[model samples]
Target: MKISTETRMGRNRRNPREERSSFLILCEGPTEKGYFTGMRSRRGPQLDVDIPKGDHISAVREAVSRVSAEYDAVWCVLDTELDKMLTASMLRAAQGSSVELGLSTPSFEFWLILHHAKYTKPFQSADDAKKMLKKISPFWSEGNTRFSDFADKVDSAYARAQQISPDGKNPMLNPSTSVWRLVASIQGRPEAIGRSTGAGRS
Candidate 1:
């Protein structure tokens, strides 16, 4: 078969941006990883987040094992959307095999998103959610994002709502809430080091 110049030119088109992008390894929960990973596929194709399966020791270790080579920085994203959780997160991030780490969670609300009843509807991208939180929380200054503000806003918002979700499995609102933290470490909007964040997402 003969090929024309147009066909050759079409084939010549290069996805340089895709070729240049890098991937990242993170072990939080599935939802958070899914949200962040999903967002990256859209905005930062160069980056990817690995989600660890199950809570088994081996799985966690496996995630850590890959961190050394697959990713640029280590992150611990979770849905603390259940009962008061303060330590489980620290433990997961510690297994980072000595890689540097960043962690985030919603307030007593568990996760950072607004949907709880269905866990699917009203789902927004990670970047969009981060911007939402900044708008809601005063501890945050819109452009400036922080996990602490996330916790506070979550906690305070939960108090005002006067209701608790029965979802025992994925307590947190998914890691989309922490995208800003992930972005800040590399390519991101200018932000403060560590302050309370905004209310996050509508």
Candidate 2:
């Protein structure tokens, strides 16, 4: 996408040029923000990242508050296994206070890929999953794998990640039920991660 990063400078009120915001990225923390920065810009001529730095919850809210006409799309990269307090906090932080929770069933697969690549720290930041990207065909394309190819491998990989007795739970490695459901939905299938809330204990 074509992003322009010339935010108005120092109270210059009447300058038409200063009315634009040239920055493009808005991330939960400096790490993910850094993830974008560390990557080779394949967009070459068309891509420029201006992601802002904010706590995951607040950053998402702030970006949504901005006009969509201003940027390509606002991505709120957040965690799935949130505790009640953190959940409430993020929901409260959401723009207009609308709470929507969802995730992909095999979210860890994504994290694993990032971890293997070290683009993110395997259990904590997006950097971790960068590791797994190497197993895919698009080795040099910066997560260039087509969605079509990666669809079937999650269950097998998740089983492996699930078995890992890491000293502690890898935050980035944990998969959310919502993410699993999202993947199912994308395949034109039903949600398959967990029992329905309606499926209470007998």
> Residues 1-202, candidate 1, lDDT per residue (tens digit)?
9999999998999876645545465555544444444444454546556656764244445545666644444444443332234435434545425443333334312234432221232323444444554454335342333344344343343332223322122224433134333444444335423422321211
Model 1 accuracy (lDDT, Cα): 0.41
Q: What is the lDDT of residue 170 in candidate 2?
A: 29
> Which residue runs does candidate 1 get wrong by more than 4 Å?
1-21, 25-30, 41-45, 56-60, 80-89, 92-102, 105-111, 114-179, 190-202
- Residue 126 in candidate 1 has what lDDT? 41
Model 1 alpha-carbon miss at residue 64, Å = 1.8
Count clashing residue pairs per candidate: 19, 42
By TM-score, the best candidate is 1
Instruction: Tell me each candidate's TM-score.
Output: 0.40, 0.36
Displacement of the residue 151 alpha carbon in candidate 2, Å: 18
What range of 10 consecutive residues in model 1 has the weakest lDDT sum?
193-202
